[model samples]
Target: METFTEASWYEKKENSIVKCTLCPHNCIIKPGKTGICLVRRNIEGILYAENYAVLSALHFDPVEKKPLYHFYPGQGVLSIGTFGCNLKCSFCQNSDISQNGIRDPERKALTDPQEIINEALDIKGNIGIAYTYNEPVIWFEYVRDVAKVAEKAGLKNVMVSNGFINETPGREMIEFTDAFNIDLKGFTEDFYKKHTSSSLEPVKETIKTIHKAGKHLEITNLVIPTLNDDPVVFEKMVEWIALETGENTVLHLSRYYPHFKVSLPPTEVKKLSGFYKIAKKYLKYVYLGNVADPAMGNNTLCPVCNSEVIVRNGYKTWTSGLDQQGKCKNCGLKIIEHI
Candidate 1:
């Protein structure tokens, strides 16, 4: 098993330094050091992905668990994630793995890429592989390798990302990835900088890039109270999604809970409902997440006739309202695809 694969999208600098261009951070690293993403290291002026083919978590998950409602809803996906992340979000949900890389080096298993594809093949009703859990952008080399094999094996690839990637790598991912659920952390630049230790523009660009490519794209905004829950800002964000990624784009307004560095109260269900209404005004498909209320924002209603098209209870989904073509049975409005 190769522990360190030669990383792509990097340049050697003078005095044994290397510049990593995988993400917008473009970290300049000295020999034996790593970039902002702890997974990629600079060894003797050569960049290597330290977490390449390293499996931290692997499971069979509902595609809705990815919170991707429209892309093959109710189907399962072989989900995998390595350690390390590009941005240091204060309220990171998966801070254990994203903030800290493999704690026990000996316990880290370097599984072959084909092994993952084989597992996906063995799963019943699994649509494909989901590069998720931690930031997939940091695990670029391994993801690309697996995606290539998965594609040849007739498996779809879904990326659950922060979308803070550079143009070259982002474009490369679009070629192989079939769907994306990008976390649009916040609407304002200040919020992104203060809470996420990143910026807003690159994520927006990545969303637009994916949308322009005609790929399945969904946006998830974890609404944090007193941070990004301002109605005006939320509306602007919804408008941006509608204008940039078409009104039909799926938007999931997830409730934020106190986690990691932040100890704020859980996002009010009322706030999520308000934002859901704001989003529904612009986007055709809007759903709320992390809230206990199932009836509020769990189902998909047709834009034309307000008829239930897809009903979801947690991960359990039933498309009873749509025919074989994924259109609303009430008014024949095309609600979703790849059903």
Candidate 2:
């Protein structure tokens, strides 16, 4: 399979340069240079997705491992990811793949989109495909192609992204992708600019855009110790999510560990508990991830009846409380739609 494909959402400029409009960065490439993503390159004024169909990792994982608590609780999904990321997050956990593009050609394979969909279909209990590990937004053309084939095969497409795409590209994602787990990062613009090398408003806009499209939207926020763990700021973020995306929106509060560049200590369990309390005030479905305590924030309860709707032990999930229609068996309150 060829690794290079003609890129979309770009404009030609004077003097053999191309401006990439796929994301907010709008990187201007000069001849042989690549964009901020280091994946899309401008070769003689023609933009091409240099990492198209080039996969770094592929696996079959539990849907909850996507940290999607509500989408398809107990089902598995075929996950795939390519290298390159639009943002330069200081503490990126997947920096080995995200920060670099197409390293070790012997390990990375260039697979076709239909082949990926075929693998997804062959998985025993797989519900669909998940574009994850690295930021899928940079792999826009490949993701669009794979999702087109997956949709026709009666499979779902889940995108675990940083939500940093431009409005036009984001709308295209909404059309092809079935569900999304967008990383909110933080609430303050200062935190976003300092750590992520991006802005916060665009991420918020992407979240709102997906929610307005009536898509299955979930938000994940990696709570760092000193940076974004302030109670007031965290509360504001939760309030905004509740107001804009509704209380039913699934929120995953993941504990941050020292990785990549940042050397800060792991988040305190007590601190995560406090934030969970604050988030519960506004959001109906809130979960704690990367913590040892399993019984704390892992289970889903009926919002109306206060009964256990879904019990999750690590990645093992059981929907014993919901009936065939995904309504609370105790009170008949609708908890999850697509179970």
Candidate 3:
């Protein structure tokens, strides 16, 4: 039997029930029962993070693989994730790890935050650690612990998340996180409710919170066929990002593939290109993912002079056209984040 870590961001209530404050779910867990995430349980009026020290997946990936275009373009990150998620999305790409809560005793036995830091240090050219693959918010305690250690070692911390966390915990997490890739599933509340079983307002709030904190942030919208691919709705989303998150906000429009339950046809390249045109109107930095055309999505251009500054070929990024200060060498336009 795997033990649990006492969780933060929760409160005790009457009849030994505990209300989880980690995310918008605010699940009121009864004694000996779990929350909506299925990984946080209330035991004698105290909430415990059941997946605290569990590991579902671990690997080293390019920063671009996180789909973060504006933050440390070519760096590699040590990505780690545990099982459990706050939302129930029908088309979850990583459903095996996200939907199923951590249950394997063997996987839990190897849970060590210090080991993560050590492994991160061992990887050559590894810039930092990324809490990714599954929803890192649900693994809050473990992430916080590892991040604290990683910070002291001068390692950057990146979070790949759904951005559904409550303000209190979200603020705390951002303190230690250097960069973030938040999934803005869709533009409408109905789309969110029907497809993800979650609301949209909290996600928007989380984006604003990250932006206001002055952290490196990027947004990914997995364009699904007939679900969130409306040109008008996508225009609204782009406009909102420009107005609220600013024009410099990095946006990635990803091509959705048949996955999990919702097996819609793969997004057409033409449709994604159309969205690219719409987003380009309001955003300074935009890219497409899961597509092969380098000219279409793998290069970054200077907003001032329209010169390609960084060229990326499936994570093998070349910054020859960018100066040491991340400026366009041709016109000296500051277009990327300096390392």
Candidate 4:
């Protein structure tokens, strides 16, 4: 039988209704009903995390694949993800796992937190663990337990999330997390409401909290062709990021493709280029993804000398122009977060 662990960040209400405090949703779940995340359920009067120790996918991937360019440039991270997500995104690339409330027979596996930490130690060149693929925030209990153990063992912890988590849990998790790649879906609240079924404010809050906590932070904006490709809106988003997060914040403008629900044509390279140009206006570091533009976007250049500090081809990374201290070898400017 699948063990159901009582969840944290929830308050019992009248007649067995429980309010989930993990995210901005604050889903008031009744007895036998699950939260919007589909992973946290109210059994009688207690909130239980349904996906505890349940893994849908696990792999040793380049840290760069987390799209975290500024943190440990060429290191490997053992990425793990489980079922369910807090938000309902129409263009969700991993909806099969993210939306699967119950464990799928072929994809589900059960492993204890210590086992996961051991797997991280076994992988060659692995710097640590990355809670990724599906929304890691939905698998909060498992992630929190594994992260605590991983940190004690001196392994770094990274979170690749949509940044919808609430303040209390987010702060607690950030205490153990070393870095994050937050998905800033779009600029407008309407964009978030219409597409992701979540709000924009909470995500911004999550980003600010992580940044203020002194963790290495990166942001990714998936550019959907007609939905969120407006130049004015895109520029405003980049400007806000630069002002609020810092000019040095690493941002990735990713091309969108037809996925789970949205069937619009793939985002154009020209749109990405335009957004990239706008971002470069205020941000010190920005990159393009999904579409190939090797000379223009994939490689990282020093802000001071314009020398290629890190060369990236797909998941491959070469840190040739970065010194041991992670400074620009040519101009001696400190560019990345050095481990």
> Per-residue error at 174 for model 4, in Å?
1.3
Query: Which candidate do you rate higher for TM-score, 2 or 3?
Result: 2
Which segments of model 3 are wrong by more than 4 Å?
Answer: none
Query: lDDT tens string, model 3, 47-95?
Result: 9888887888888999999978777778899988888899999999999
Tens digits of lDDT, candidate 4, 1-339 = 246878988998999999999999999999989988888989888998888877788889999888888899888999988889999999998899887786663433545788888888998899999999899888888889999999999899999999999889999988989999999999899999999999999999999998888889999999998888889998888888988889999999888999999999999788788888899999999999888655569899998889999999888889999999989999999988654
Name the lDDT value of residue 39 in candidate 2. Answer: 88
**What is residue 49's positional error in candidate 3, in angstroms?**
0.7
For candidate 4, what is the TM-score? 0.97
Candidate 1 per-residue lDDT, tens place, 1-339, comes to: 246789999998899999999999999999989888888888899998888877788999999999899988778999999899999999999999999976655544545888889889999999999999999999898899999999999999999999999998999999999999999998999999998888999999999999999999999999988988889999999999999999999999998989999999999998888888889899988899998977779898888998888899888999899988888998988878878
Off by over 4 Å in 4: 105-110, 293-295
TM-score of each: 0.98, 0.98, 0.97, 0.97
Report clashes for each candidate as comma-separated counts. Answer: 0, 0, 0, 0
